[model samples]
Each structure stands twice: as C-alpha cells, then as structure tokens.
Target chain A: MATGEVKVLGSWSSPYVMRARIALHIKSVNYKFIEEKLSEGKSELLLKSNPVYKKIPVLIHGDKPVNESLIIIQYIDDTWPSAPSILPSDPYERAVARFWAAYLDEKWFPSVTSVGIADEEEAKKAGISQMEEGLALMEEAFGKCSKGKGFFGGDEIGFLDIAFGSFLGWLRVTEKINGIGLIDEAKTPALVSWAERFCSHAAVKDVMPDFDKLTEFGKMLFPKIRALAGTR
Target chain B: MATGEVKVLGSWSSPYVMRARIALHIKSVNYKFIEEKLSEGKSELLLKSNPVYKKIPVLIHGDKPVNESLIIIQYIDDTWPSAPSILPSDPYERAVARFWAAYLDEKWFPSVTSVGIADEEEAKKAGISQMEEGLALMEEAFGKCSKGKGFFGGDEIGFLDIAFGSFLGWLRVTEKINGIGLIDEAKTPALVSWAERFCSHAAVKDVMPDFDKLTEFGKMLFPKIRALAGTR
Candidate 1:
C-alpha cells in the first residue's frame, strides 16, 4: 500500500507546507497529505526522506523525495507538463519569476521568523523594520514583475505567484499578531490585490487551511518563539 | 559596436561574479567582462541593466539581462544546451544539486559574510565555528550525493560541483584572512579532497582568478568590513 504514490510530509501550520499543497492542487495531482507534528521528533521516514534539511514539506513522488517547497513545485511542474504551467516558457521570464521566488524564500521568510520570535523592545523594533523591508522589496519586485499583467507571469498564475501566495496566508496572521498593517491599500496595493486574486483562484482556495485556525495557532506559537529568543 | 553581444557587469573579487565567469568559460561562451568599482557610484549600465538588485554579476546575454549568479548559470546552461551541462539531467539528481546550491546561496554565504566583518575577539571564535558547521553540512551532503563517485554527479563535473567550486575559492581566502583553516586533510577529508579535485579540473583551473591576488584583496577588504561592523 502507498507504493509509487505522491506523499507530502508536512504540518498544517507551515507556510512552506502550504506552498507544496497549492502547487499539487493547481497541477491537479493526486497526493496524500501526511501531517507531521514537528514538536515531536520527526518520523524516520521524514528523516530518511530529507536528511539534508531534515524538515517538513518533503514531497515524495514515486518513491523519490524532493525537499524544499519551491524545488518541489518545480519538480511538480516538470513532472506534470500540461495546462496550468506554473513557470513561464520563455527563459528570461522564468528567470525573473525564479528570482522573485528565491527573494521571497530567502528574505521574506526570515523576517517572518524574526517577527514571530522578537520580544525585547529594541529587538521587536528591529523585527518590525526587517518585516517592513521585506514587504517593501516584495512590493517593488512585484510591481516590476507584474507590469500591465494580472499575474506574476501575466494571464496565468505561475510558480512565483504560487510561491508568494503561500506566504500571504501566514502574513495576514503575522500582521494581526504584531498589530502592524503590511500590504495595506496605501503601502502595497498591487501586492494586496495580487494576494486577493491569488487566494481567490479555485486551486488555491480549495486547499487553503482555515484562516481562523491558523491565526489561533500563530497566537499560541508566537509566545513560545519569543520565550526561546529570550534564552538566546 | 558590440551589438547583440554578451556583457558581464561584475566586480573582480566577488565569488558570485566568478560563478558567471566560470559558466561562460565552461560553455566556451565569448563575452566581454566589465569590472565595476563598487565603492564608487555604480555604472549607469549596471544600474539600468539590473534596476532591482543594482549589483554585480549581471549577465547581459544578447539583449536580455540575467541577475543573480545561480540564475545566470541556469540561463547559460539553457542557452548553450550542447555545451557542458551545469545541472544534472535526471530530475532527482537535479533537485539535490539545486538544494545544495541554494544552501550555499542562502545559508553559507551569509555566514561567510559575517565572518569577514566580525570583530577580532568575536570573529575568530564565531567565524571559525560557523565555517566548520557549514563545511560539515557540505561534507555530509556531498558524501551522500557523491555516493563514491569522483564528482557530485559522476565522472563529469556538473552544476553542484561548479557551484561549490566557486565558494571554495573565496572560502580559502576568507580562511586565510581570518587566520583559520577549513577543509583540512584530517577534518572534512572528503570535502578537502573534493576541493582539490575540483580546483584541478581544467574548467575551474582555467577560469579561477589568481589566489595570491584574491588573498591580497581579502586582506584589504577585511579591515574595511571590520571597521564598518565596529560602527554598527
């Protein structure tokens, strides 16, 4: 049983996890979602599957494990080359899309982590500033990448859109917890609009976790992160 | 009149810049390399070409610009398919290669930057520790990926090897500046051997900048970076 099946080992709350799920859904691929409780020791399967990262969102397709949410999406795109292409056909456009996705993965995610954990008065300020800087870069990059286009790749929701789309769900929670409005109408109207459009897509909407549950989870997790940061 | 010609806008000492150069050389691509003095105001062409990053290693292939060293390499590989393949053809192997390349880009690069700037008292300890950690990870990953093979993929040197190869060049200089030794014969022996084999490759040996000059440049950069960090 489960041989040659597509299995995703992930947690319900991880934004990176959501990315893989969204990609799978968009591509209309059938897969089993195995929710892992990361607080406990990771399962042996998870460890063996992704020994390098030893983290969640490990997409095992036909017995081969692909770690890294963005990479997994690329693997899916490559494996299922059909309608709803997640990346552009043109190499130049593909590079731009990948650059933004990489930017989001590297820059934006760190800020989210900082904000999630920052506690000291000064440290909190630094965290907020970092978050704002990430948002500003995202806004600027999105503006350039989405000139006169609906989606990041124009007329289609590609990998860049899907990659960033996963973060929006978590960002909303982060904004609420931090009491700071990023992606506001004044600050990042285009990004806000894109987030709205992205979340509205049937593929995205169908797999998205309950927002209220996520916010509640964030509320619980934020304090623990802050407490850990204090020890550091 | 260099119409439709390839131009690389980069600084002389940058590892990222060297990545682009190596890719071009390996692919036998004919291009003009424009060295930018980053201390001064960046050149108009560099800024215009990569308006977002406004940094070095902007590869102007024909009429299009590709920023980000890894992205540029991917573009180069795509453009020159018949030449030496940078990435592995197999999907799983390619994903593993991309993962390590990203690990270097996201994790190792930042640690190396911090090492360059940290104060003397803190730098030696923290920098050495960070370097060792990164090296350990690299060694483990490489050992698993290499699987008794000569190179990362097999007999042929591939993308993973090339990406790690560029880092090793800078790492040597950085270690020398910091008065520490990484990739020694005893510790991380596999990686050290890998580095030795990698550096000996015709492609790498031909394109790699002179180590003596790089060391001299590192000596100059270290003080400036330390002074800047002191202020911050």
Candidate 2:
C-alpha cells in the first residue's frame, strides 16, 4: 500500500513533465500520471490548483498541486527524505547542483527554443552560437564536478543529473529536428558519457518516453511554433 | 563573537544584491559588504569565487562564496535556523513561497526589462501593464498569507518577503526612471502597505541603497541599454 496517492498533471511532450516523472520514479513513489492537453487551454483542476503558472507538471499529492518542475522535485525529496536524496546534503554541493539546474532553465532552454525557430542561415548561426555558449558554460561547470565522480553530486544521480537528464533527451530530439549535431561523441565526451549513464539509470529509463515519438512530435510542432513566432 | 566571518560581494544598485543584504540583516548575521563595479567586468576574486554565474551578491562565509541571491538567502536561513526562519516550515507553504520567488525571477524581471526598452509611449503602457500583472499575482499570493498576520509568512519577514521586497525597491526606481506608476496606494492597497511596511523594517531599511542615487543611475544607464539593444 502507498502512503498517499500522487497525481501528476502533465503534457505528453514537455521535458518539464519528464523531470517530475523521473524524480517520482527514482524515489519509488507511486504516482498517477494525467496527460493534459495544454493546447486546449487547461483543466479546471489545474487552473484552480496552480493559478499562477497554470501549466503542467503539477504534482497533486493528497489533493494539493505543486507547480514548477524543480520545486516539485524538491517537494518530493523533502517528503521522502529517507528515500534516495535527489539533492546533496552538503550546502555547497547542493548550491552547485541548484546553480546548474537554474543554468539549464535560464540559458539552455532559450537557446534550444531559438534553434527550434531558426529559419534564415543567419538566424541558425545566431541560435547555434547561443546554444554553444550555453553548452560551454555547462561543460565548464560539469568539469569542475567531474573529479572522480560518476554523477553531479558524486556516486549517485542527484538533482543536477536529473535536471540535465531531461535536457539531454530534449537536446537529442532538438538536434534531430534542427538537423544540427551539437553533442557529438567526440565533442563533449564527458557530457555524452553522462547522458549515457543517466539514461541507463533504472528510475530515469522507466519514465522516459520513446525518443522516436518525441522526434516525430518535435518535427510536427516545429512548423507550428515557427508560424506562431512569425505571426507575433 | 561569531562562528564565522561573513562577507557580501555586491553592487549597491542591484536588486539581487539587496536580497542577500536584507536576508543577512534579517537573520542578524554580521557581515562585511563589498560593492563591485559590474561594468568593468567582474573582479578576479569574484570570478574565482563564483566562476559559474560570475555575478555579484556572493555570500562568503569564512572562505566559501555562495553566488545567486535566492541561494544565498536559503544558505543564511539554513545556517542561522534559530533566528526568524526565512521560509515556512510547512512543505506546502514553503513550496508556494519558492514558486512565487521563482516566478518573480522567471517572469517578472524579463517583463520589466522588456518594458524598459519599449518606445517612450509604449514603454509606459507596457511597463504599467507588466507591473500590474506582477502586482496582481503578488497581491493574491500575499493576501493569502495576510490573513491575521503582518508579513507574508504570517508573523516575521520570511523568504517571500525578502524576495519580493528587493523587487519593490527596484520597481519603484524603475517606475520613476520610466515615468510610470503601477503601485499607487489606491490601485494596490495591500502591496502598497506591504512595501511601506517592508521598507520600514529595520533590517531592510538598514541595507537599502539611497533611492535617489539609484534613480539617477538608472536614468543614466537607460539610454545606454537602449543603444546597445538597438545595435543588437
């Protein structure tokens, strides 16, 4: 029997949703996944629950919805502290992990979104440059943490690893959609290895959607997003 | 005597810096302040200490420098748990506080920055609209906690108050620089009261920079920022 029912209101194709799912699965927490059709506005439950964001990856535990993917992960960790700790215990390490997580949120997402909408050669160049800059920062940050450590917080998959895990999945699909190879095996070998290791983790592997499906969806959505941007 | 020597590397005009200063002050932590000139690039110590972000509001305890404003606030609260807790103990309430804090970082700042560059007439309209939306969201969040209490956390100033307090000061200055007012006493009575109450708090009042100087600096920098944006 489970302590309480955990429900996740999420869109099928959002990387943020994947983040929460991975954390819950890793912690061995039983959760019911609710796929929300975000294009059709949102459910009343979601709107009422997360009036501020009103977006998915809303984790409803004991009928309370916790919005924001990172916050949701932290909530899960705090609730199930005895289970696998997603964040490191040491304050410094935890801060570093959070910094990377935030970097991914702030820098990486925008760069990738740019890639998704790049039309002209110059636009593609600009987008690629931004993406490379973001990647370089991540590489340097991870290099600092790569000293005899299998994971970001060492010896185990922690917050940074989980945060980047979702990004790597999205990056792969993005590369396919954009027809750009930013993360080749030769380039960013450590990050490449880290991605491999992350996907192999049982918890992460279980929650991951089919890559082929994601690529198909990305291809279908790219034109729509570009059209929307053009209209704007 | 204190267990450790605290040092804060920050710029006087930065909202981010004010957050760290206010957090330390509220906790009654003894700390030295170093104001960095951000235009000349970061100092060697600042770069070395927070190589990742390479930005100010780096909280140095003994030797370790913790970068990022919100992260530093969390560290201060964790280090000095005996004092007024910056975040509520309840996981749900804490999550809500973190969500709003993150929302301010994610949505509010960008919207305000966008407003800053809009054409003079458009700037006022956009600035007022953006600030209104931000204030409305904040008003609801604060109102929820305002029941039977003076502060966001009910009794004493907490994380949400500190996070939002820094914004209030900047918003006021930015409103003056941009010549738009969204936080009038009649429009947002609760938020207006909160800002007045926050500014009057001894800890907040102690660390706040001279508002007139900040307004003058913002006026000076406005055209430069616009010129750079135009070129880009």
Candidate 3:
C-alpha cells in the first residue's frame, strides 16, 4: 500500500543511517533520501516521523514512520521478501543474525564511537580497550557465521554483515581523528580482512560514503563531540 | 532436532529472565529451568553458553543458546511456529512490534531503572520525567496497535506485551522501594490497565514469580544497586 512511496530520513555520516541505505540497496528498495542537520536539531519531519527518539534514519513507508535502524532494516527485509533476504530463513540462524546485530549496536559501535568523544587519555584508552574486546568478540562471531565462507554471514552479504560493515569507513575515519591505530591488519587481521571484503562488495561500495569526505566531516565534528563529552 | 532439551538459564526477580519464562509459557513450550546465581558471577554453563555478554535469561535449545530476552522470545516464536506467534505475520505489523520493543528497551526500561540507580534527587527527578515521556509514547503506541482492542498487540498478548509486561512487577516493586509513584492510573491509565490485563492472563500468571517474594527481593536489591551505582 506504499502509495506515498518509500523515504529515508537520514544523514551521511551516521552508521545507523548507512544501515537503512544498505538494506534498501540489497532489497532494491527505491527510497527518497532526506538529509537532516543532526547536530543543529531534528527537523519537523524527522520529529513527526520519530517523535520518541527524534533521531535520524526514520524509514517512512507510505504514511507509517519506522524508527531505529535495526528495526528499519528488518522492515526492509520483511517488506520485500523476494529480494536477497538480509536474515536467514532458518529460525535459529535468524536468531543468531539478530543476536550479533544487537551486539554490534550495543558493543562494537558504541565503544568505537566512544574513542572519538572521550576527551581524556584514560577514557579514550578504556574505550579503545572496550572496542578491542568487542572486535575480538566479533572476530569470533564472524568465524561462527562464516565457517569457511567469504563473508561473516556466509557466501553472500547478509544482516550481520550489513550491521557491522556499514560502519567500517566511519569507524576508520573516527579512529584516525582520535589518533588511534585500532582495526589495523596487524592487530586484528580477521576483522581487517572482513572489512576489505565488505568494501569490495557491490552492495556496500555503491552506497558507502567516500572515506576522505567522511574523514573531513569527522575532523569538524569529533572535536565538538569531545568538548561536549568533557575532559576527565 | 531438539534431542537435548529446551532450558532457560535464569534467576527470578529479573524482568529479562521473566521474559524468557513468560515467552516459553505463552508458547506452551515445555522447557527445563536452570537457576543461575547471577550476583555471584555467572556459572560456568551460563558463561560457556553466553560468552559475549554472559548475562542471564539465555534460552538453550538443543545445545544452541540464544541470549538477549527479546531475541529469545522471537526465537521461541520462530522455533515453535505452531504456538501463538509473538510477532505478527504481516511484515509491517511485525516491524511495528519490533520498533516498540526497541523503544521499551532503549527508552522505557532504562529510564525507569535510572530512577533506582541515580543518586541525586535532581537525577532521579530527571529519570522520572524521562520515564513519563516514555510512558506517554507507549500510550500513543498502544492506541495505534490496539485500535479499540484489548492488548497493545490486539486480541492476544504478543511481543510488546511480553517486552514491557514482563517488567511490570519489577517496575512496581522498584518504584515502591524507591518511594516514587510512576505507573499510577491517573498518569498512565492505558499502561496501568494493560498491566492488569497482562497479569490476569493465564500465560503470564502461570510463569510470573510470586509478588510478595519479588517485592522482598526488590527491597533488598534496590539499596544494593543504588550503592553500586554510587548513590546514598
């Protein structure tokens, strides 16, 4: 019944927003993209769509606004079942897929982002350590999901891949801005290789933001975030 | 293929653990229960099963363990599809259910717990205000989901009910212990009535912990949690 057409309320730099785009691409969902100046304040449309959080990456399907990236991605998958299924068809496998996505959202992403906003050396160090722990867990998770396959989610790109893969560029750029050498091949070979595979994928390559452009954006914003987070 | 057994690694007094129990009961899935002394640092079985987070309410099915309560409930629905579905068959409705569950996890649950953990009166007040905000949203969400029906899920208890309903007792006990009134009829009539309906249901009643014992547990744990959270 999507008479009004599909639209995504998002900004370029957010990994969460990237998820909505990635799912759309994989599902071949043609959605109108609306950018929001996230730092200034949420737009009226964004607020109206997602009044609870007032955050970006709201997927407007016809008149209904679906907030939260994971939920939105699943919505995309559910809405368009014929398109390359993001999650596995098997029940247990689907649960495994969801579990990792939640882990990435709760652990991997936040810890990595913490490195940028935390002003103090100790806090940044803690964040780095936490990120390393999360990465280690993801490395293990990838092994289980792949089990001698190309992607973390078997041969083709799947939900977990989209979940973590969407953030590789932003995570890398943020790490450089924070002046940390996390996610290097030497330290985390498995994850680094996984990132490479992810970037090479047409689904990711077509949609991901340019690294240099993202880095430039990070330079402007990371400092402000650091200030807001306050020095220890 | 569940030759081993269905088991829940959990302890009473946890809304998360309650969710697993409630979901199992609602689905009428017969499962063994393993009581974990979470405060004493997770047991080896619990650790091995759920290494990433190592938290409780892990639903073990035939040796495969599903962590995270929401994921577990969905897993139950998926594994036992013959039973009542926790989520709707319709993709859009399913997405809506997930959105609200995420909202409860991210907004409602945390803000309510914030009241317990926060030390200062100002912080607690802020937590209450946020919880109020979350409840108001849930009120609107219920209206949308119900559409002149009984449950937020309409006609039957479903995912959102399990998500928030599982915590009603814990929330009420915590509120009493903290000496703050949150879910009063005047403030959150819709939610209040929903709780009454949820508790009265055979599926929820059969599995939920005894109220008097749970209240005693909350009284003891609240102060300890407050101290750990660094409050007076």
Candidate 4:
C-alpha cells in the first residue's frame, strides 16, 4: 500500500524518531529513511523541512512535511485510512488516547528521563518517587484505555502503545546503567507487563536499537545530561 | 442546540480555563459552570472528575469527563460537530493546527508568562528575548494558517485563534505591567491584528476577564511563581 513519497529524517538515539518509525511500520507504509548526523548539526533537508525546530522525526508525506512525532503519527493514520487505525475511530475514545499520550510526554517521560541522569543521591531519589507517581497515573490510564483488552486500543497495538513503547529502550537503559529498578514488578506490574509486550511486538522489533548499543549510549549520554541539568 | 448534559469546572482567572469557555461559547453548547478555587484546595467534584491531574477545565459531557484545555476544546469540537468548526476539517490542516497549538502551549505560553514574573533583570531579559523568538515562530505559523484572512482558521475565528486568545488577557496584562513591548506594530503585524480581532469577537469578548482585575492578579501572582519556580 505504497502511496509514494513518504520519508522520515531520524536520529538513532532519539526516542521520538523511534516513535515515527514504529508508527510508519505499523501502517505498513513504504517510505525512505534518512539518517541524520546529529553531532554535525542539522542536515540541509532537516533545516529546510523543519526550520522552526530543525529537529529530527520530521515525516514528509509527498510535498508536505509534518514535525513532532505524535502529530506525524496521526498524520500517517489520517492519510492511510485503509491501514489499521492508530487511534480509535470514536471521538471520545480518540480524545482519551490523545490525553494519555500527552500525559506520558508531559508527566511521565521527563520523570523517567530525569531519574536516569539525576546527579545527587537526594535528587535521584526524588526522581525515582516522581517516576513512580507518574507510573501509577499511567497504570490508571491504561486500565481505562484498555478496558480489559490486550492493548490500549483493545486487541490491537495502537497510539498509546507506540507512544509508551518509544521509551522502552531508554527505560531499560536507565535501569541497566543507573543500577536502579524503575519498573518494579511490585509497584507498576501492569506497566512492566506492557513494556515486555511492547518491546517484543513484531513491527517494533525492527527499528529498536540493539540493547548493548543503547546501553553504551545511555552510559555516555546520561552523565552529560546530569552535568547540564545541574543540582542547583 | 442544547446538549443533554454539559459542565465545566474552571478557575475564573486561568487562561487555560478561559480557552474552555471560549470553545464552549463558540460551540453554542449549553453547559453548567463550576469555578474551583485553587487556594482553598481541590473541590470534591474536580478531584472526583480528574483524579490524575486534579486540575480544572474538566468538561463533562453527560457523565464522561475530558481534562486538559486543548483536549477539552477538541472534545467540544468533536461532540458538538454541528457548531462552527473549531479546527480545519482537512486532515493535514488539522494536523498543522494541532502542531501550532502545542507549540504555543510549549514554547510561547511559558515565555510570555515568565516575562511577567521573572524576578531578576537578567532572567527578565532572557525571557523577553525567548518570548521574542517564540513570537517570531508564531508569526510564521500565522502566515501558513491564515493566508491573509482574519483568523488562523481563515475568515472566522478558529482553533489557533482560541489557542492564542486564551492568553490575550495575560498578554495585555504582561505588556502593561512588565513595560516590555512584545508585539510591536512593525514586528508582528499579523499577531497584533489577530489579538485585536480575537479580543473583540463576541464569544471571546464575553468571557475575557477585565484588564484591571487581570493586571492586579499578575502583580500578586508573579512574585509567587518566581519563588515557586525557583531562581535557579
């Protein structure tokens, strides 16, 4: 079901780019992939396409360019109506899916990332607790969104799954490199299960970086984030 | 047309809540209003409705509840489909509107608000320049969204107008209190004109709090935000 011109400018380390990759893969859309050299600064294509942010995970559908991973995923869903629905067709359900996705970005994602790099012992503790709280909220959201189904959109993998799964690699890396147990089976059992299911999903398996490489990246990147974020 | 049941839990002075009000008013949907006083802590209804965030601007349609200002507005758009289109009907256009709305919330909104409350001259200067950059991005977005029309939704006031207009009162108050010129006539003619047109729109005009009262709120509230946000 190739509709011609679909291209994604992505950076391997960015979870956001991973998100766009998984979404496009799920829709079974054929497209081109352009690897961006992040250390060398934004590519000309990236600079021209997403001049505002000049950031990756810019999905180009034909002549138009859509930036932002979540928005791009939705664009893929809307454009490819015949493909499996990334979001539920019901308006209210769709809104619920969107709200949780935004919640993950706002409340959960940052907390998870912060725990991976927090310098001070006290701040790391605080970040852990904050992440726990974020997970609890996510647990509640999953109960509501899934309604006793396999995935957030019922029996199929959907938007929320993709959004949350984007972070699975990073989450594992955080646990490994930081020597912290983030997704404790005791506290966030549902989320832990969801993480296992999501990482092993068919479409997701291809794009996710190898665990060893990701862990190496995490070890290198996290201390830099800690240095930059500062204790003050 | 009257809905079976509708309710809004809001704060009198919250720009986010105001976004909900303007959206509801534009939809011409009949609904109940309940103002939550934050200083006194969360209302039982608010806590019950939105246990996760425990924030206001929760719109209840029948028994179902939707939280987050942007999400609520989109809910209003979807539920009250007969009313004026809150967003462009085209999928691509809708994605563009969503992207800019998120940009305003993420980039522009904070910069606009911070300038009003930044305690140090350096911080204030930084905020002012950051806001200038954000506004520049917005100016570009308006060019694409409006295409020489009155609002971001073309001839009529639409989603982006409501998104930006949510901050109109705060923008005016910031300009008046901070003594900083954000939207100069020569610099952002389109935004300046849009602000004027939005403030006067009938649905928006009725709900926007008085200038004097909002300015007073800014005076009392800003120092507190600076303290809570921390000087670091």
DockQ scores for all predicted structures: 0.40, 0.42, 0.66, 0.50
Q: List the candidate 3 regions with Cα displacement exceeding 4 Å.
A: A1-3, A38-41, A178-181, B1-3, B38-40, B178-181
Backbone clashes in candidate 3 total 0
Docking category for candidate 2? Answer: acceptable
- What lDDT tens digits, residue by residue, belong to model 3 across residues A1-232? 3446999999987789989998888887788998897657778999898876788889998998888899888888888889578887778888899998998887777887777777788988998899878777787788888877878778888998999898788778867776777777777777888888889887778668898899888778878877776655
Q: Give the TM-score of candidate 4.
A: 0.93
Q: Per TM-score, what order, best first?
A: 3, 4, 2, 1
Cα-based lDDT for every prediction: 0.81, 0.81, 0.83, 0.84
Clashing pairs in 2: B86-B159
Q: List, residue by residue over A1-232, the lDDT tens digit for candidate 1.
A: 1137899999887778888888888788899999897677799999999886789899998878899998888878777778888877777777878888887877667877777777666876787787777778778777777776878867878888888888877788878887789888998888888888888887788666678888898888888877876789
Off by over 4 Å in 2: A1-4, A38-41, A177-181, B1-5, B38-41, B114-117, B174-181
TM-score for all models, in order of appearance = 0.87, 0.91, 0.93, 0.93
Q: Residue A176's C-alpha lDDT in candidate 2?
A: 80
Whole-structure CA lDDT of model 4: 0.84
True contacts kept of 1: 0.50
Which of candidates 3 and 4 reaches a greater TM-score?
A: 3
Tens-digit lDDT track of model 2 for B57-157: 89888887788899888878777878678878877788888998998888887777766666678765776687789888888888886565888878788
lDDT of 3 by residue, B166-208 (tens): 8788777767766777777787788888888999898888667
Query: For residues A107-191, could you state the per-residue lDDT of candidate 2 as single tens digits?
Result: 7788887777777878878878887777777666677765667777577888988888787766888788767888766667677
lDDT of 3 at B151: 91
- Across A56-171, the per-residue lDDT of candidate 4 in tens digits comes to 88988777888999998888888777757898877788888888889888888888787778777887788778877877877877888888887887778899889888888888
Cα RMSD for candidates in order: 3.6, 3.0, 2.3, 2.7
Q: Kindly report the docking quality category of candidate 3.
A: medium
Interface RMSD of each: 5.7, 5.1, 2.0, 4.7
Among incorrect, acceptable, medium and high, the docking class of model 1 is: acceptable
